[model samples]
Structures are given as C-alpha cells and as structure tokens.
Target chain A: MRIEVHLHPPFTQVVGTRTLPVELPDGASLLDLIERLRMDYPNLFPSLRSPEREEEVRSFAIFVGGGEVLPLSYKLREGEVIEIYPPLSGGVVPKLVQKTRRLIC
Target chain B: MNAGYMGKVLFVDLTRRKTWTEPLSEAWARRFIGGSGLGARYLVELSDPGVDPLGPENPLIFMNGPWTATPIPLSGRHEVVAKSPLTGIYGEADAGGHWGTALKKAGYDGVIILGASEEPVYLWIHEEGVEIRDASHLWGLDTYVVDETLRAETAKTAVTCAIGPAGENLVKIAAVMHDGRDARPAARCGLGAVMGAKKLKAIVAMGNRRPPIHDRDGLMASIKAAVPEIKRLAESLSKYGTSGRMTTIEALGDLPIRNWVQGAWKEGAERISGQRMAETILKKQYFCGACVIGCGRDVEITQGPYAGVQGAGPEYEALACLGALTVVDDLEALAYATELCNRLGLDVISTGGVIAFAIECAERGLLPAKVDGIELRWGSPEVVLALIKQIAHRQGLGALLAEGVRKASEDIGGLALEFAIHAKGLELPAHDPRAYNSLAVGYATSNRGACHLQGFSYIFERAVTLPELGYPEIQDRFGVEGKGRFVAVTQDLMCLFDSLKTCKFILFGGIKPTHLLAWFNLVNGWGWDLDRFMEAGERIFNLKRLYNVACGISRKDDTIAPRILTQRRGEGGAATNLPPFGEILSQYYEHRGWSPEGIPTEETVRRLGLEEEAGKLRAKAVMKV
Candidate 1:
C-alpha cells in the first residue's frame, strides 16, 4: 500500500520536504510504518523511548487525516495522509550567550 | 535580613502627592514569598472588595519576587496586582522586561499606589528618591510613544512601564506596556484601565543597587546545572518563536479557529505559523531581560497592504486571536493589528476575542452592518485595525467592545451571550479547554477570569511532566478524569512560579521543584524545603481564591462559557469531547478544600493561617456573617 507522509515545521527543515509518499504493505500498523521510516531515515526522527523512563515515550505528536490523533496500533489503509511533528519544547529563549555571533547573527 | 530582598515597600499617594517607604516585614515575606502572593496580600489589606475597580480607592501594586533581578534564568519578571476592572475580582498579570529589574535595583520590593491624581503624573524613581512628575504632555500617547517619551525625559538607562491611550481612555481590555523598543505588555485583567483611572501615565525607575545574594556560588551552581537543557530548548524556540507552533497547536485542536466556529484550518495555520514570520517578515528575534529562549519576534512589513508596519510581531495568542480566530490569513495585516494593540496598550488576547465576538455578532445581524462607515466582517483587516483604534479611543462601536465581550454581548442582546466565550468578564485566551480537560477547570476558577497562565495545565497535559511531583510527562489530554486534582495542584505550583516572578518557560525546560527551592534558600537564606515551598504555593493559591470569594465569587462563578461546555469539534483530534465541565468543577472545588459553593472551609482557612484574613472578609461584609 502507498501512503503519504507530511512533516510539520522544524521536521520539514530536517527532512527538506513537507510531504512525501511511502510504500507500505497493506494492513501495516502505524508503529510498523514508523519503524520502516526510522530505518529509511535514521537521523530524521528522535527516539520514541525516553532516556530517563527506559520505556517508549512520545516526543512528538502524530496526526492522521485532518489532525486526528490515532493510536499506533491502528491499521494504515492505502493513500491515507499522516503528519509527523517534531519534539516541541518551551517558549522562546536560548542557553549560553554567544556575545560575538549569535544564532541570528 | 534575608539576602534576596530590598526589604522596602514604597507607597505613592497620587491624591496627596506624597511618597513614603515602609520596611517590609520578614514574617510577611516568609509567608507570602513575594510577587503575586505578596502583592495579593497588600491588595487584600489596603483595598475594599466592593471598591469600584476603576476607582481611585483601588490600589495598584507592582511586586517583584525573590528570584527577580538575579541571574536566575527567566527571572526578570514582575507581577501587577489590582482589583480587576474587568472581572471585578482579584486580578494579577505578569510581564517580562527590564522594568522589573530596574525597580528591584531602585531599592524597592514593591510599590503601592493609592488615591487618584487630580492631574496627569508619572513617578520617577532615581538613586536619591521617587518624584511625582507632570505627565500632562505624555497623556493621549501610544504605549511605544509613552515609553520613548519617558526614556527621553528620564535618564536614558531608566526603564519605564507606561499606559497607552487605551488605558488613558479606560478601555476595559487595556494592558500596561513595559520595555520601550520591544514593548513587553502585562496584558491581562485590565490593570491598565486601573492605572489609567489613577491618571498615572508612566513609572520610571533607574538605580545601580542590587539585592544582596546570600550565596552567590550556590545560585551560580543551580543556574549552571540547568543551562545545557535550557540552551537546547532555547535554540528550538529561537528558530520559530511562539508563533511557529501555530500548526502543531492547530493539529491538536487547541488553536481557536473562526472564533470557535470551526475545528480545523490547516492552510490558514501554516500561513500564520512562526516559520512563515521567520521566512517572510521577521527582521530580528527579541528577548526579554535575561531570557535565553528569546521567543519574541520583531517583524517589519516593508510591502503589502500593511507596508511600513514595523514592531513586535504576533505571538501565539495574538496569531490565534487576530489571525486564525477571524480567518484573516493576511499575515501582514494581522502583524499590523498586533503592533496597534501594543501601541494602544491593549491586551491582544482580549482584543482578538472582543473583535471576534463582535464579528460573530455582526454576522448574525445583531450589530449594525457598518459602524462609523466601517463594515464589520470576518477576514476584514481594515475593520479589525479600525476597531482596535475605536476600542482604545472609546470611539463608536469600539466603545462597546472596549467593555469586553461579556458586556458587549449583553448590550447587543439576542443570543449574543450564548457565544461571548468568557469565563467571567475577561475574554478567553487562544487555547480551547475541550482539547485539554484540565484547562476547562483552570479557566473557570482563574481569579482573574479565563486565563491560561494562571494554571497552564495544557503544558502538563501535553508537553512536560513533574516527575518529582508524580505527574507523568503527559496526561490524557482529552480525558476528563483526574483533571480536578491535577488543576488544583498545578495551580498551586504555578502560583509559586508567579510569586517567585520566574517565567513559566523554565518548567518546559525540565526545571524541577528542587531547583526552585535551592534558589530560594541561596538567595533569601530562607532554607525552605520542597514541601514547605509548595505549602506556601498552596497558601498563596487559597488566599487568592479567598480574595475572590470575598469579592462574591463562588461555585456559580467557576464556570466556562456554555458554548465550550456543550460544543464539540465534531471532527479533528478534539472530536467527541465536549468537556464534562460540571464534573471537573465539582472535583476541583473538593480538591481545593473548598465548600461546594467554592468557599474555603474554616478548617482549610485556619490550616493555611489565613483565618484572620478570612475574618477581615466578613468584617468588610464581603462574606456572610
């Protein structure tokens, strides 16, 4: 089965594209699709397992078909659209000051 | 003496043209923990509950917390407390800028203004003393103009908090403007209207004194420990600022769209996202005092219908209210509207909310088709901009809107209140409670009305967790279960943050309670542990709730708009969730140790050592004898 994968914001910055088509086997679960994508694009996504928890954790949110949250166990049908979001942190600030040349500079 | 405080509270009586300084009580500081907590205490003791919020008898207090003016990350904040002209209850708003730091350096822990000035005046606090100066020339100016005028008139290094024309005209949604160039606004609860009512235009403070830090080395160590994670998070925020998260928030069904008329607007969300601002209009990123995350934006619209519009860009709330809520996809126009709000000293959330409410009313023919020859319609940028001026100037239809959605709808009549979308008189911010169940209770019980910062339960529901407090990183956002207890606990935690004058952004960076406790001990030499600090937080929360109860707020006031409680997204991620508000409110009241009417039981009141304060409420006839 063929499904389209869309990335939002900084994820698009990392992946260099907003939308992409992925070839998946019919009846593949959402986690299976994620695993396949992880193998294909190793550096694009953060790990689902948290370093602190030593178990699976959700760093980014996933939405299916017009911003609906579906479980990873849900089966993926052909031509369905899935959007993968990047890990969002707090509102604006920076760490150490680079007095000479900052990020904006 | 504790290390982190100036131990002086300044009192300025505008009516008498007099100023006095009183040494702060150590016992009071220990119990209140400064900032909003201390400010609330002063308001309770000094002002009457039945006093008109816009009257001179109501005192406006500015307070700094123990962490303020220190090198602690995100600590350059102050709380503005007053009897809310909008909510007619306990009101507080926090702002980040250099003004708070300047005030702290000028040898003051807090300032209380009482009585109205017969003529316009501004207070100048220098090394020697504070002087009430004539502000007749600065009257009728915009916020930025007032800021610039004050800086020019005072020393160049002086930081000023000024009111714009909206405040001067007593617009109910007016917000106090802080910082000059970037223009940070303490834009909540209509405190600006309170200031305007006092005929106070600006407060300029400049000094070189710093609060004595008891353990500088320990404070440095605490900050160093949190720096790396803070830097990483800050970098992410610097890329997009607050507006960049529009798409993600929209995806969660948390972003308000078309004034809560629709569920999803993917294309519109993208058009107004922070990424779009960075690529198109952003000239530079703005940062508050000592903020490493620098989530503020400075944008310039060089060309477009809004060409030459240049100033602070839209934050998430502004983007949601001015852009998405009205379906105005033209980013430049929305940016211009945001600039106008800052200039007029208007709260963007309330401005957007009131305008959206007005548009919804006009669509239903409840309002005139054209007000002063300006047609009212969704996506009409001119009308939005025009109405902002109107609200600030109290002109035409803007006069009605300046009173806020609750009053505006009441005046408009005919099913308008059904869609006004406010908890009390204050308009709702951008977040939809239906997306996160805790937010529903947070909004209903917020002392200053429908406010997000009061609890920020959404952050707990989605992004972060307090593992030390046993709250998992993420709670079930759509579920109604466990929300009441969660809201109550988090409200206390956030109240502590507010009292400390620390920015809530640090919580997202995984700052723990231990870190906060360490800062308090090191700076103030209080030696408070986590439990003790949290108890103070709870005490502060309950005290503010008691203040509201004194103002005649009760269980009936702990309610959300009927539209939010009854309506569902019907599609999208928030679908099928109508927010069981009644159940959540009941649980919240019980968890808060309040009676079913949302009044603190005598047992709970005495346990928090607020029995005297509660008794005062009864003495003032704000409570039943």
Candidate 2:
C-alpha cells in the first residue's frame, strides 16, 4: 500500500520535499512508518524522537486522517495521508545546543 | 541606588498639572522585581478596587524592568498595567520595542500617570526632564500621525508610544501603539482606553543614558556564551517570523478557524502562512532592541488592493484571528487589516474577535443584515476593512462591536452568547484551548483574563521541558494528570519573564531558570538561587490574583467561554477531545494552595510574603459583604 506524508518546515528542509509517497505493508503501524522514515532519512529521526529519552517519540506530533493524534500502534490504511508537525515551540533545546556548540567551537 | 534600574519613577498628575519623582522603593523592588510585577505592586498601593477603569482615579502605569536598556537579549520590552475597562479586573499588556529602552535611558524605571486632564496633553521626557505639552492639535489623529508628530516635536530619535482615534473615542478594545509603522503594541486589556480617558495622547522618550549594570563584564560573558545558540535555534523564527508556525499550528488543530468552530482550514492556513508571506510580500524582518531572534515581520504590498499597506506585517495572532478565524484567506487583505488596526490603535486580537463575533451574530439574525450600508459576511475582506473603520470611529455597528465581544454578546442577547468566545470579557488569542489541555486551565486561572503569554505552559507540552521544575522530559499533553501542577509552575516562571521584561521565546533557546537567575544576580548583584527566583514569580502571580480577588474575581469568573468548554471541533488534530476542565482545575487549585473558590489561602499568602495583599483582599471582601 502507498501512504502520503506531509512535512512542515525544518522537516521539509531536512527531507528536501514537502510531501512524500512511500510504500508500506497494509498492516503497517504508525510506528512502523516512523521506523521506515528513520531508515530513509536518518537525520530526521533525531528530531522526531525526544532527545532526553530516545525511545520516546514525543518530539513531533503525528496526525493522520482529519488531524486526529493516533497512537503509534494504530494501523495505517491504504492511501492514508500522514501530517508531521515540528514542535511549535521549536526543536529540542538540549540537542540543538549541543549541535550548536559543536558548530561554534 | 540599585544597579540595573533607573532608581526613580516619574509621576504626573494631569488634573493638577504637577510632576514629581519618587525613589523606587528598594524593598518593593526586591519583592516585585519590575515591569508587570512592580507595576502591580504600585497599582495596588495606589488605587482602590472599585474605581472605574477609565476614571480619573485609575492610574495607568508604564513600567520597565531592570533589564531595560541593558545588553541582555530580548530585554527591550515593557509592561502597561491598569484596571481594565474591558474586564473590570487586573489588566496588563506587554510590548517589545525601543520605547521601554528609551524610558529607561530617560532616567526613570517607570511612569505613573494620575488624574484626567481637562484637555489633551502629551509627555515629552528627555534625559532628566519631563514636560507635559499640549496635544490638543494631536487629538483625533491616528497613531502613525501622533508618533511622527511627537518625534518631530521632540528629538528625532525619540520613541513615541501613542493612541489613535480608537483610543480617543474610548474604544474598549483600543491599544497603545508604539514605533508607528514598525508597530509594536501593548495591545491587550484595553489600557489604551485608560490612556484616552486621562486625555493623554502620546509619550515621547529620548535619551542616551544606559541603566547602570552591576557586573557588565559577567553579564556580557554569559550573553556571549548564549548568543550563538540563541541565534541558531531562532533561525527559522528569524526567517519566517511567528507566522512561520501557522501551518504547523493548523496541522495540530491549534489555529482558531471560522470563529473557532471549524476544525480544519488546511489550504487557507497554507495561503496566509509565513512561508507564503516570505514568497510574497515579506520584504524584511524587524528586530527589537538587543533581540537575538527577529520574529517581527516587515512587508510591503506593492501591486494589490492592499498596495499601500506596508511596515510591520501581520503576525500569527493577526493572521489566525483576521484570516483563518474569519474564514478570510486573503493574505493581502489580512495584511491591510493588521496595518489598519495598528494605525487606529486597536488590539488586533480583539478587533478580529469582535469582527468574527459580529459576523456570527449576523448569521444567526441577531444583527442587521447590513451595518452602515455594508453587508456583514464572513470571509469578506471589504466588510472586514469597513467594520474596522466603523469600530475605530464608533460609527454604526462598529460602536456596539467596539465594546468587545463580552458586552456586545449581552446586547445581542439570545444565541449570540453561544458564539462569543472570551474568558472573563477578554477575547481569547489565536491559540485554541482544546488543542492544548494545559491552555484550558491556564486561560481559566490567568489573572489578566485569557492571556497565553501570562502562563505559556503549552510550550512545555509542545517542545520544551524544565528540569528545574521537575519535568526532566516532555509530558503527555493529552494526559490530564499533573497538568495542574505543570500550569502552576509554568505560570510562575512566566511571571518572572514578564517581570524581568524578557521574551518567553528564550525558553526555545534552552534558557533555564539558572540562566535567568544568573542574569538577575549579575545585573542586580543579588545571589538568588532557583528557589528564590521561582518564589518571586509565585509571589508576583499571587499578587495579581489578589488584586483580581479585590475586583470580585472568584472561581465563577475563572472560566473559558461556554462554547470553548463544551463544543468539540469533531475533526482535525484536536478532534473529539474536550479538556477534562474540572479535574485539571481542581489539581491546579490544589497545587496553587488556593481555596476551591480560587482565592489564595491565608497560609499560602503568608508563605509567599503576600500577607499585606491578603489583608487587603480580606478588607475588600468585608466591605463587599
């Protein structure tokens, strides 16, 4: 099955596209799609997951089908469109600061 | 004299035509800090609870924090405080520009305007002198004209904070505008009406004096260490300004659409977004004094109906309120409307809110089909522009709408109340409470009535975390548990920001309580730890709450609009979830150590060193009974 993904800024800048179509299994969960994206764009994963707790995907809010926040375990349907929004308050500060220090130093 | 402060406040009695300078009480300065906190302390000391907000006795305060005129980033801001004509409760508005810096440079920490003038007048403060000049000719002029005229009359470098015809007409939703076309407005609580009631037109400040810094070297080192990261983190914000978040907020169902009834307006959101603005009319970015993040937009409409519209561009609130909320997707028209609001000294949030409310009222036959021969319709740019004029001039339907949604809803009667979205008379900002659960509680308990900046706890739920506040990791925004404590903690921290006159956006750059405290200590030569800093914030928050209590604000008044509370968007990111308001509010009260009636308890007040404020509240309560 093919799923459509909408990426808002920083993510768009990262992924080099506003929208992307990816092929996934019919029974793929939201987490599975996230893993797929992580595999596809390794740089995007760091932003999507919490910096303090990497296992937690609390950094970005993922919405599907009319803007409902679904659980990561929720199954994705064929032709479903997923919208990923970067944190409205900006990115994770600690990691960004570390990265910024690395660049500055 | 304390370091980092001007050490004195100028008091002007318009009726007596007398000016005096009072030493800023060192004890009170330590207790309240400055800006909103210090202003609140002075307001309570000066005025009674039941005084009419627009009356001669209700003092209007323009206050600067210790950080003003300092080299600290995002320190170029000030607070305007008065009893609100709109809410009849504790009121304040914050603005970032050069005015606060100018005022500090003019050798005053704040200015307290007392009594109503028999005629129009303006204050010219330069260096160590203040002259109250006749502004009779400046009357009825727009803010732009007043700003320019005052600058011309004073020094060319003078920064003018002025009110336009909306304020002159005593519009309840009027704003005190600054920087003219590069508009920065302390645009809430209708304090501009208070200025108008005093018959004071503009305040022009010009000076070269910088507030004395205790340890300039240390403060500069700390700032230097933080500048690179602050700038890097704020890159997107610098590029797109605040409107950059439009699409993201829309995606989260946080954007108020169609008077906050609709769940989604994706295409419309994209069209008016900062990204769209950058690709269109966005000419440059505007920065405040000592600002690292330039989130202010400067745009020009060169070849459109809004061709003449230029200068400060519409921000996220303006775009959401004037564009998405009204279902008007025309970015250019929204830009024009924003400029119009600025020129007329009208609060953009309230202007958009009243316009939206009027349209909804008209839809339900609560209003006439046409007001002033112009049809009232949603998504009509011409109608929106015409209504803005009418509101500022108090012409026709504009007069009723200018009273703000709370009064206008009551006047309309019937189902009109159903659509009037406000918390305690003040209209809600662009952010919807349903999208962020913390906002529901924050809006209810906020002292200034439904202000996002007052609490700003939603930022924690979204992106940031305060390890010092016991949140080492981002908590579940959807979860109801512990949100009460979360909001209380964040609100206290936000109070510190407001008092310090620092932008809350510094949180995005990973600024912690320690950093804030370090800056405070470095500037004032005080060794306050995290606990002391947080306590000061708690004291400030409770002080404002005590003031509100004196004004008869209780648990009954601490609530969002019924529609916002009960109605579900039923689609989009926030679909089908009403905030569990009761449980969250109970936890909030428990955390705040307030009684169920939402009044600060004697023990809590005593603990925070607010015994005097509590005693005043008790006195007011006794007088009422």
Candidate 3:
C-alpha cells in the first residue's frame, strides 16, 4: 500500500520535499509508517518516542479524513493523505524544543 | 525606599495642571506587588464603580513591577488599569516595550492620572521631574508620527506610548501603542478610549538610572539557570515569530474560522502562517526591552498591492481574527490591516472581531449593503482594509462598529446577537474555546471580559505544566474532567504573572514558581515563600473580582456568545465538542471557593487577606454572600 505524506515546515525542509509518497506493506499501522520514517530520518525524530518505552511513540498530529487523528492503531485506507506533523503542534514548540534538549542529553 | 521600587508615584491632575510625587509605602508594595495588583488597588480607592469609564472621574493608572527594568528576562512590561470603557469592569492590559523600564528608571513606581485635560497635552517624565506639556499639535497625528516627533523633541532615547486617531475619536476598541513601528499595545480593555477621553496625546519617559536590586548575585543565578531553555525558545520564536505555530493551531482547530460559524481552514492557515511570512515579507525580527524571546515581527510587502506596507505584527491572534475569522487568506492584506491598527491605535483583536461580526451581519442583510459605499463581505480584503480606516475615523457605518460587537449587535437586533461573540461587552481574542475545554470556563469567568491572557489555561491545557501549582502531569485538552480546577489554578498563576508584569512566554522557557519567587525576593529584598506568593495572587484575583462586583457584574455576566455554547465544528480535533461550558463553570466555581453565583466566600476572602474588599463587595449586594 502507498500513503501520501504532507510534510509541514522544518520537517518539509528536513525531508527536502513538501509531499512524498511512501510505499508500505499491507496491514501496516500508523506507528509502522512513523517507525520507518524515524529509521530513515534519525535526526528528525530523536525525541519522538516515550523514553520509558521506546516502542511507544508520539507522531506528528495526523490530519486525515478532514480532521486530526492520533494515528496510533488508526487503520489507513487506500489513497489516504496523512499530514505527519513535527512534534511541534499548535504553539507547543517550546515544549518540543525543551524535549529535544532532553533527548540530546 | 524598597530595593526594587523607586518608592515614589507620580500623580497628575490634568484639570488643575498639578504634578506631584508621593512616596509609595513599603507596606503597599508588600501587599499588592505592583502592576495590575497595585494599579487596581489605586483604582478601587480613587474611582467610584458607577463613574463613567470615559469620564474624567475614571483614573488611568500605569504601574511597573519589582522585576520591571531589571536584568530579569521578559520583565520589560507594564500594566494599564482603569474602569474599562468597553467592559465596565476591572480592565487591565499589559504591554511589552521600553516604556515601562524607562518610567521605572525615572524615579517612579507608577503614574496615576486624575481628571481629564482641558486641552490636548502630553506627560513628560525624566529623572529631573514630571512635566505636563502642551500637546495640542500632537493630538491628530498617527501613533508612529507622535512617537517620532516626541522622540525628536524630548531626548532621542525617550520611549513614548501614544494613542492614534482611533483613540482620539473615542472608539471603544482603541489601543494605547508603544515604541512606534515596533508597536506594543496595551490593547485590551479599551484603555485607549480612557486615555483619549483624558485628552492626553502621549507619555514620554526617559531616565538613565536603574532600580536597586537587593541581591544581584542571587537574581543572576536564577536568570542563568533559566537561560538555556530561554535560548532554545528564543531560537524558535525568532525564526517564525508568534504565528510560527499557525499551521499547528489550524490543524488542532484552535483558530477561529468564518466568524466562528465554520471550522477546518488548513489552506487559509498555511497562507498566513509565520513560515509563509518568514519566507515572503519578513524583513527582520524585533524584540521588547530585556526580552530573550524575540517573537515580534517586522515585515514589509516588497511586491504586490500591499507593497511597502511595513509594521509590527499580525501575531497569531491577529492572523486568526483578521485572517481566518474573516476568511481572508490574503496575508498581505492582513499584514496591512495590522499596520493600520497599529498606526490608528486600535486593538487588533477587537477590531477584527467587530469587523467579522459586521461581515456576518452583511451576509444576512442585517447591515447596510454599502457601508460608506464600500461592500461588506467575507474574504473581501479591500472592504476589510477600508472598514478599519473608517472605524478609526468613526465615519458613517464604522461608527456603529466602533461601539463593539455587543452594542452593534444590540443596535442591529434580530439574529445579530446570536453571532455577536463577546463577553461582558469586551471582544474575545483569537483562541477558540471549543479547541480547549478549559478555555470555555476560563473565558466565561475571566475578570476582564473574554480576555485570553487574563487566564491562559489553554497553554497548560496543551502541554505546559507547573508542579508548584499542583499539576505535575499534563492534561488532555479534549478531556472534560478536572478542567474546573485547572482554570482556577491557572487563573491564580496568571494573576501573579500579570501582577509581576512578566511575559507569559517565560512559562515556555520552563521557568517555575520557585524561580519567580527567588527573583522577586532577590529584587525586592522581601523574602516570601511559594505559599505566600500564591496568597498574594489569590488576593489580587479576589480584589479584581470584588471590583467587578462593585461594577454590578455577577454570575450572570460570566458568560459567552450563545453560538459557542451550542455550535459543534464540522471537522477538526474539536469536531464533536461543543464545550461543556456550564458544567465546567460550575466546577470552576467550586474550586474557587465561590458560591454558585460566582461570589467569593467569606472564608476564601479571609484566607487571602481580602477582608476589606470582601466587606465592600458584600455591601454592594451584587456579590451574593
């Protein structure tokens, strides 16, 4: 299955493309797509996961079906456009910036 | 003299042309803690509740905090408090710029203006003394021109806060702007109308001396501890300015769309975002005095219709109210509107709000087809720009809009009141209550009438935390539980911040209550623990509530637009939520120790040392005991 990903700023600059089509295996969850992106772009998602349990991750607010979704266990349909936002959601940049410092440490 | 305060307040009686300096007592400083608290203390003592807010009897008080003009980052702020001409309640607006610092340096803790001037005049404050000068010439100029002309006449280094024609015209949504093009407005509360009614043109402040600090080393340590996080926050802010998070706000459905009638405007958000501004018209970043996070924008449209349109902001609030709410995706036009508001000294939030309300009325044929011959419609950038000027000048249909949404809607009658989004007569700022459940309660209960900054629980609702305030963990913005307590706690915290004249952005830098207490102690030499600091905040909050009670505002006044309470968004994070406002408001009353009617209990007042205010408020009978 193929998913359409719309990258927002900073992430857009990081990925070098505004819109990218990524190929994913069938039955892949939203977390699967995030994990693959994190693997490919190591620097981008340094603080993307919960420290206590690395498998548990926070994805960019997923905007699909004309609304935002948590994307965890959210099954994707064919031709679904997912906006994988940076952890920077709504003026929450300060928190994310602080989180980045902790992750680096 | 206290270590932090200049220990003197300047009193100017405009009618008699008398200027005198009175020593500010140490006990007063300890009790009120300056800025909003001190200003309100003065206002309550001097002005009567029934006094017209635009009348000569209403005193305009300017106050600075202990941290103001110090090495403390984000301390260059001042509060303007008066009986609001707009809301008719406790009205206070905080502004960032050099004026507050300069005023403090000029050997005064605050300035209280009593009686309106018979002629247009400007107040000049220097280290030498205070002078009430003839300013008949400066009365009609734009704020930028007044700033320039005053700086050229008074010392070049002097900082000035002035009102433009909107203020002079007595437009209820007018603002008192500071520092010209890098304008910082004490725009809330419609204080500019009060200033205009006073016949004051501008205030010029220049002083070289810094206020004394009790423990410089200790304060430095606190600042140093907070610097790393401050630097990180500043980096992001400087890169994108305040609207840096525009896309995220839109995605989260926090931004108001189409006059709060519709939601889901990602394309509009993208066009007016900070990223787009930075990519296109952003000329440079600007900063307030002693500010670490330079979230201010200086932009000019280099090409297109709004070419050479240069000014300060289109902040996230402006972008939402002027852009998304009006459905005008033209960023340049929005920027031009921002520039116009700054120049004319109008509050962008209220101005945009009033204009959006008018657009909605026009669509329904409630408004005249041609407002001074200009068509009113949604996404009509040209009409929006023209309406702003007409409002400032108070010309024709603009005169009705100048009275603000509540009055305008009342005049228009019929269905207009249903969509007139205001509380207690003051217009709401950009953030939508639907996005964050806590805001619904916060907005309804805010002392200063639908102000977001009065109790910015939305920040905490999103992700911010303060363990000292008892919330160790972040709460869900969508959840309904615990929000009543959340609004109560955050309102108290914000009251302290407002009293201190500290920037709310400092919260983003991870500064906690401990750091703030430490700095206050070091600066003022008054050693107070966290509990005591919080006690003062509680007292101040109650004091303002008491002030409102005296003004006849009761539980009935703590409300929002009907549409917000009933309407659900079609799409977005808050798609299904039509804020449980009443339920949360009841919970808030419980946490606040207030009666279900929203009057502070005797026990609560006694605990916070607000017995005097409690007694007065009880006598009013407006506060249910």
Query: Model 1, range A16-90, lDDT digits (tens) per residue?
Result: 898989998888888777778777776555433232221122334344555555556778989989887644443
Tens digit per residue, CA lDDT, model 1, B1-625: 5888898989999999999999987887899889999999998899778899998899999999878888888899999999999888999999998889899999999899999998899999977999999999999988788887888888888998999999999999999989865778899999999999999999999888888998887677667757666655445566688776788788888888878878888889888888888889999988777777788898888775789877788888998998888888888888899989998899999999999998888888898878799888988888889999999999999999999999888998889989998988888999999888888889999888999889988877766666657674467777777789889888888999999888887765556665677777878877777788888999999888888887888888888888888888766668667788888888888887888888889889988999877877767747562
**Which candidate number has the best DockQ?**
2
Clashes of 2: 2
Q: Residue-wise lDDT of candidate 2 within A1-105, one digit each (tens)?
A: 999998876578779998999899889888788888888988774534433332135334334455655556778989988887644554445554344334322
> How close to the true structure is residue B514 of candidate 1, measured as C-alpha lDDT?
59
What's the C-alpha lDDT at position B547 in model 3?
83
Interface RMSD of candidate 1, in Å, is 9.3
The regions of model 2 sitting more than 4 angstroms off are A1-3, A8-18, A23-80, A92-105, B620-625
True A-B contacts kept by model 1:
0.21
Per-residue lDDT of A82 in model 1:
87
Compared with the true structure, what per-residue lDDT tens digits does model 2 show for residues B347-393?
99999999999988888889988887888888899888999999999
For DockQ, candidate 1 versus 3, the one ahead is 1
Q: Name the better of 2 and 3 by lDDT.
A: 2
Docking class of 2: acceptable
Q: Which stretches of candidate 3 lie over 4 Å from their true place?
A: A1-4, A21-39, A42-82, A86-105, B616-625
Report per-prediction Cα RMSD to one decimal.
4.4, 3.4, 3.8
Give DockQ: model 1. Answer: 0.19
Residue-level error in angstroms, candidate 1, position A37: 5.2
The per-model DockQ list reads: 0.19, 0.28, 0.17
